[model samples]
Target: MDHVPGGFALNPRFHRIAAVEVTEDDLGRAIPEHVIAQLDAHLGLLGTSTGYASGGWTAADFARMYQVVYAVLRDTGRRPGEVTSLHRDCLERVDGKPTLIYDNHKRRRHGRRLPVSESTAQLVETWQKELDALPAVPGCAQWLFPSPGQRNRPRRGHLNAAQFCNRIFRDWIDELIPDLVDEQLDENGAPLAYDRTQVVPYGFRHAYAQRHADAGTRPDVLRELMDHRSLDVTMGYYKVSLSRKQEAVRTVAALAVDRHGAARGFDDPLAYEVESVGVPYGGCTEPSNVKAGGGHCRIRFQCAGCDFYRPDPSYLPALEQQIADLRADKEAALAMEAADWVVRNLDDQIRAYSKSADEMRRKLDVLPAEERAAVESASRELRKARSAAAFVPLQALTARSPE
Candidate 1:
């Protein structure tokens, strides 16, 4: 078949088209945390005489080449063809940092330099030593990852790097694709499980994109890192998982939950009756309709420290409960390894809550003794109820370490 030059330039102006959009199969098939831990262990065993699984492929023997390939894919997000074309001394330090020069095989370009993470640079350095130790392929001295000593084509490098790397990936697919469905002669001779993950070599690249997206990397930056031709390709893998979406909804709802509201501001020296649905941080003197007409306040829930806010002594219990709820939310966010921005926001809100708590305490101190006592008693009762509601087993608790 004759090669078509500048294929992208050829466009059909005459015929209408319905291009088939390819759905992403591995939507959320990121390398699981457990699997990542396993990979780390596998990486550690490399260069050492340790038997890894039953593949008869140990680190000391056939591991170096595969390890280098895997590390490049993991760290650089380079394609298989690009990996095969790499040469020794590919490292180019710029601004006191290591960068890798990768050849863009798909684009038919030469020497595309990309800044690399420190850990990946280290991996490349380690792989360099192993590459040096291997016997040089007569005609392929420049190829960094030369094909392992072949019987006939000894001089030629990995003729098909994509296929070779794929075989290595498949060999380790058991650990990589633990949830991969298997063909079996079951009762129906078919499967019912959802093949959510793509059990292919490309999963590594997919995983790279997915991880960056989850870490909240911008599309443009991610595109540069992944070496994608279009932002749409990078974004295609930036799918929001159901759990993440649900967490987002819960976070927003938690901000807007029903809370005790004080009917009147504390500045009004005369005592006023506390309405059933009064907000505790009462600063809005605007008529309800007028307040509604203005767009919602960005810091609506931050009533405690608001300049126009007044904390009613009557709703001290509810105010304290907000603090407790914030503590719980902070714990939940940390447990989930929620985004850095989210964790920081929760921490900032906690600081804001502290200010609000101080404000409430100051107002209560000036209140009549009887009124102050009543608020204190309500707070104590609420604390006890909350404690009882969130009971943990004694067996789960261990004594704190002595300082």
Candidate 2:
């Protein structure tokens, strides 16, 4: 066939695009607390030994157990290819820190060093001893994750990332589903059935990034830890889950107020959901305003003076700044001999924002120190979530025209 005309044509594999179906929702979401609990419980049941080829458990199971747990603890968001391809002696003590020496094959970057926790280093040590003791299979001695399959391609014998995810990992999850409980609840208030689709091997990396983001890791630090070439990719993995957002919303709601700076009660969070239309620094409660995406404001965007305005402590800084700006504009209008209406408008805005700012500060000052700190933290999270790139307008993200 090699001698035939066009027999040396380019390999079809190079020409074909691989179409991998994404079977999960939000692949970047952290594994649920309950699911993580279930994983721990199940691993406890399986016992540590990688049983013989004749029965109970295999090396693959043990390798996966270590891999998943290590991935979680390390929180480095490494790819499965990187983990599965680790050499037998992948750990080193560099500058008194346990560092992992692995290859980022996908990026064509080899021998990358990552500082990891001592506990994770110990876990790797345990796996190394366990792998050494396990019954040897053909062509499997060199890899951290030796493939448990019978077919041996001696040159490339480690667990394939795709097979590890689609088969080895999926199979283990199947056995765990009956014992798994989801963080969500059904209409009957019962714990919902576990969604297996949510717990893929790759999602651990996403979870790692999220865990750090929630713990207030700086963006540049996170980007370095994630080993991404750019900050944009790192930001993609940083998401504040809906539950976190709701919690922040509830916290900020405690200090919510109307335009008059009077305290507003949102006893039921569900009812607060009705006032969903967001304004610059707060929310609009009027039905018309909410339905019109805050565009049809009854007070024409004069949020500080509108009865429907529901500003919380999160808006305090912006409100104070607005007051200062309005005052400056008023002075400028007075100096320019501007129309009475323009000067009066600026004066009214300054007064309204000043009243709101004073009320917000007064309420904040009276709270217990710990509660005040919590409110401040929640306000920060809420503000950050509001301005997250996911909500940015599409056109705003595009490059500006040369003109």
Candidate 3:
């Protein structure tokens, strides 16, 4: 089959079941008014139920299925190999709430508990309710949802597999949101359609990340919540910065302020003028780091040379105290940047040591009896280099005289 944009084979079965081939108009068309109404009702029920319904799924059965899969992904973020390890103990009831306990693969421990976010927790609550409401299939646990089988027995355990859920998601998208489907060509010029639902996954994670970003959550907090090991991974791999979103909010807020002032005919022309000037750049009016003998500081708010600079003299003593509070933030940011760089460099050194060790082992395997001593000496030198590098940071710290 030709690969679809999102990534599943276009299930021929959906075309038969849905009994309709979506045309280009259908693909590009807005969701029908009836569908919108149905969605509203579904959302209302889902909000009351807990959070189990799939965000995009229109049918109750499909929504329940997607909810279950989403819960699994939100809990583990694992490939198939780790799914079986997700048991009841892997979850917890904290403060009278049910929560997942994420195993830290890097730490190799279950004690590293990662609580489900509020949104995800809400979803799980609704899903659990929905799942409970479903009629139990014969030969299955009370919690099991009905499957498409003769006796409605629980679907095969493999149904929980990442690949399987991915496939199902693709098929569901192809059947319900046909416009999302696309075609690809094979080497023989044969056309095939694949499902790409997995590519975007209905933008749930995007929406989740966006909510925190919009609320001005710190990047570090976002990284931790997103389970990203690095801030760069969270910022670069996930999405754009929160600043852009804040800018959007600022734009709307500015207009609202203007509208309110205009309605009362209490216009502050100076305020408009200030707004027109916008934020200043570089060190034009503020105290420049240049005067401090430090290289030109790029700290936006701290730069005395910046045109947008407002001095402490302009503010009351109480306000000046508030401004002084920002010094801690500046120091913290600088420290975080320094620590991140140190960690990255240490990681690189560790990787290099591992590579060198592997090479030395290979050389030792092939060394002749006479050359064995020389090979062993080279290995010892490599180990010494690695050990010395480990102590370099500590040595540098001790070498520093009183500040």
Candidate 4:
């Protein structure tokens, strides 16, 4: 077996176990006690291992990994890759609300708010507490799960690598529910029954969706909560069983029938008495002999044709002047605010860079004259390039252009 990067060995024939296909059956089978113990020990060593000096797995990494895989399994009836758009930061709490933020392969962040189940919330809370207790490693502050051997730089966090950690969790689930691997074949030669007794890591998410349906959550709400771009996708993926769909249909049908029975005729006197009065049609004008004249009649509802119509040309100049003044004030305020914010942020960045540069210079000062001179020359060129750049002022950049 080839030595995997994080204290584990993989079959030599397989280039990477991380990319290997893991079926429910593969994960559902019983894992011996020794293997479980080994896995736990490995996870325990992740934070303290000096071998992972570059950066190693941290508690946050495990939490994030658990959430992503769980969401995929829950949101889609199937596992990962079956669902095309899984959020990367699938378990973030924003403004006291659970949100799922996805990053594209290019590392751009986009996200959606997720409606969390009580169980999922509890699990997340437990994980958050555990993560808060772990000490932050220097230089790995940005990483949710730091890897080993990364002392001075952030590690490239792997989504698939995190998912692979579910192997141990899956094993534990199988131990609790031994019948998970058992299957019954149907007439179509496909499995009619698949074991789903104990909750695996992925099962947490499945349970989430199921609970929502059981709670009689609306389909549109479910679609939004699950962060599905299309309602059809949500229906196809998360709407697992026919029984749930039938229940939803029945509920909607009952509501429709009730609405139909309760509806009143348009001419009902009681309805008119109860409802708020709307604008009277034609506004107190007789229905007959309506002509364009001194009467309530004009050319297509014009003042000449209708008594209610009145021209207001006198307010035009005043309105325009008011709008112009308001626009000028708005522009000035926006410009000032933008300029202030930019200056503050820029000052912060400048201070940080200056501190880094001073530290570098101090380190070089200890070196011989030739090395120090070379470093100083490089620094001077960098400063010149930065100063000469065509960066526009922040206010000018954000200012609206004249139409």
- Taken over the whole model, the C-alpha lDDT of each candidate is 0.54, 0.69, 0.38, 0.37
lDDT of 1: 0.54
Minimum summed lDDT over a 10-residue window in model 2 is located at 47-56
lDDT of 1 by residue, 1-403 (tens): 2565444343454234744334433345555434544455566333233243222223454566666677777666676677767877788789989999988876677788888888888888887786667555566677766555443433465435754544555546533433444333358877443343344445566677766654445556777877765445565554444454333323221112121322233321122112111343332333342255323544665655444344443344565677788789989988999999987877776776566556566656776898666555443332232222333334335553332
TM-scores of the models, in the given order?
0.50, 0.54, 0.37, 0.32
Superior candidate under TM-score, 3 versus 4: 3
Give per-residue lDDT, candidate 1, residue 220: 64
Off by over 4 Å in 3: 1-63, 71-98, 103-112, 117-119, 129-159, 178-198, 202-215, 235-285, 289-403
Top lDDT hit: 2
**Candidate 4 or 2, higher lDDT:** 2
Which candidate model has the greater TM-score, 1 or 4?
1
Top TM-score hit: 2
Q: Write the per-residue lDDT of candidate 3 for residues 104-207, one digit (tens) a residue.
A: 44335554555676665665556656655665444333222233322323343223443334454444444434333234567778654433333333233444
Misplaced by over 4 Å in model 1 are 1-29, 43-61, 174-197, 241-244, 255-403
lDDT over C-alpha atoms for residue 268 of model 2: 58
Backbone Cα, N, C clashes tallied per candidate: 6, 0, 20, 22
66-169, model 2: which lDDT tens digit per residue? Answer: 45544534355687778878877888997788988889886689999888888788888887787677666557667776655543223247767776676656
Off by more than 4 A, model 2:
1-28, 44-75, 135-138, 151-156, 238-250, 253-380, 383-403
Clashes of 1: 6
